[model samples]
Target: MVLWENLQAVLAQRGVAGFGVTTAAPFPEMAARLEDAVASGRSAGLPFTFGDPATAADIRVSFPWASRLVVVATSYLPAAGSPGAGVPGRARIARFATRDHYRPLREALEAVAGLLTAAGHRAAVVSDDHRLVDRAAAVRAGVGWPGKSTLVLVPGAGPWVLLGSVVTDAELPVSEPMRRTCGTCVACLPACPTGAIVAPGMLDARRCLAAVLQSAGWIPLELRAAVGDRLYGCDDCLEACPPGDRALATATAEQGSVDVSRLLAMDDATLRAEFPHFYVPRNSGRWLRRNCLVVLGNTGGAAAIGVLAGYAGHRDSMLRGHAVWALGRIDDPRGRGVLTRVAASDPDAAVVAEAATALAGTLTG
Candidate 1:
């Protein structure tokens, strides 16, 4: 108990918003739920969620001797007036990725691990890493309750906090689980732009625009419209929650948005330097470019047609396909002409298919 108290003090000094300790027992219920989600194909296209369910459900599997888990939540919400508002022609980034919150949280967790090690106990830190189900750990630790959006919702802080944990062999006093519930609140269900929240606490990652944007390959045509001006992740469901409003009020707005045109103009090196957090594959700018194209099509004016037109014949089939869609979305004669050219001569079958679809929509409408 003294060690646990000392750890709590250490976390408090490190600015960890809330934390609790729980026994590292296997979460059979969580494992069952994950298995169900995967079996139902609700977690499709998410590689991280596809690992061994048993391992993910148990901290002890990752650290065989682990007996205590310290779960911590840190608020990443920025000050209310930092930036991220009223920026036209810019794609919106999710609040969590606006800054590097993980680095700080990791540093804090490492410090906690060090404290445990100094006391002759073995400890391992995990954050954003897939060693265990972080939300489940946080719930068991009494740090927060899981909201319908599948995010851990801390009282007053809502879902704006990032979660991490320290797995240790020391037997510490365990905290009680939180008693709060969402009750009759279903605000996050209909608020999902892509209907990703299929039901309370159940998310279909396949239909999630946020997951689609991060995923490799072409964005499906059916979901592109719902993606709208988002360049990276979606926050509609979180934003609609009542608790989330309070979180935003205290959170500082992110400093800036990536201008859609500027992003399109950036090369690989420039994109990486500007937004290091984005999961750019092999340091390629194509993914960012693909997202930018979508935002341009959703929000750009006549000038955007010219920018998108240039990519109609890009070497990358994915880019070329999205460019064709962007052109049709702009629905300008020049864009239509470019789509027509791509439909006739694009070497890639996928690009040709996308161009044909875009052209068909344009011609008929």
Candidate 2:
């Protein structure tokens, strides 16, 4: 108890904001998963050790061991007037992924780890590394529950919060569970554009736009159409939550609104300059460009025809395929020749079929 008070003071004085500390469930299933992920070399940048629970148990059994878990929620609201605001011609970026936080979050947890070590406890900090479910751990540590959109929504900060965890061999007083407050509200469910939420708590990752975007390379046609100009993560579910809306508005106020048009107008060098930290380039420029084209197609007007046409002959097959689809939606004479050329040589059956259909309409017109 005295140790808990000391640690709490350390966090408060260091400008570290958080809810409270809680204990992890001593379950074999959790331990096994952590072991498997770490042993298989899958826990590259993750924070948990392969034998974390065992290590803690060993220390407690043989020595005067204390085990405690501290969870923190950091505000990662985007800049005021960010591109997340409702606008045409630009794609949306998930607020956390868009801004830089992984580095700072890591630093804060390191401080917590140092405090635990100084108190005669072994400590480790956990961050998301594309494998571990840190959110689940945080939730169990009484941080928060999974919102309907499947994002962890901490009370005051809402779902815009980023989570971090500190697992230590320090026996400290545990904080009471933060009660699940998602009572009777299904706002996040309907907010999902493609109905990907499936049910209240389960998410079908295949249909999730954020998961899909991270999956660069060859994108399916139906999915591409659903992309709807969102080059990065989809915020429909988050923006749909009643609590989430206020958070986004608050985030918007703090960070500014995000304009899609500003993003669409960027050249290669300009995009690099504007978004150097973005992960959009993992699939190269084609995926994001294709997403912008899809958004333009959805908006359907004479305005974006030139922009779609410009990418009609892009070197990447993925970009060319999506460009043809965008041009098909535009239904302009300017797109006919390019669509014909694409239809004639396209190796992908889906792209060819759509191109043929569009070219047929052009010939008849």
Q: Which 10-residue window of candidate 1 scores lowest in summed lDDT?
A: 79-88
Q: Candidate 1, 298: how far from true, in Å?
A: 0.5
Count: clashes, candidate 1: 5
Q: Pick the candidate with the highest lDDT.
A: 1
Global CA lDDT computed for model 1: 0.82
Alpha-carbon RMSD, each predicted model: 1.8, 5.8
Q: What lDDT would each prediction earn against the true structure? A: 0.82, 0.64
| Candidate 2: tens digits of C-alpha lDDT, residues 1-365 | 77677767776765543546665444455456556546654433234344354542232232233365578777565432245444555556666656575656677788878878887788877665322356665676676776877688876557766677777767667777667778999988876876777778666666777767755655556776677656667677766766555656655443323344455557666765565555653525555566667777666456777777766666666766667877777667777777888788877776788788767755774
1-365 per-residue lDDT for model 1 (tens digits): 77777888889898776889899998898889888888899877465535677888887777999999989998776532233633546788777777676877888899889989999999999877666889999999999998988988998778878899999999888999999988889999998988889888889999998788888888888998787888777778878888868667766545546688887887878877887876655767788889889888887767788788887867788898998888887768998889888989988988889899998988997
Clashing pairs in 1: 78-251, 78-252, 79-251, 79-252, 80-252
* lDDT of model 2, residue 236: 73
Per-model TM values vs. the true structure: 0.95, 0.77
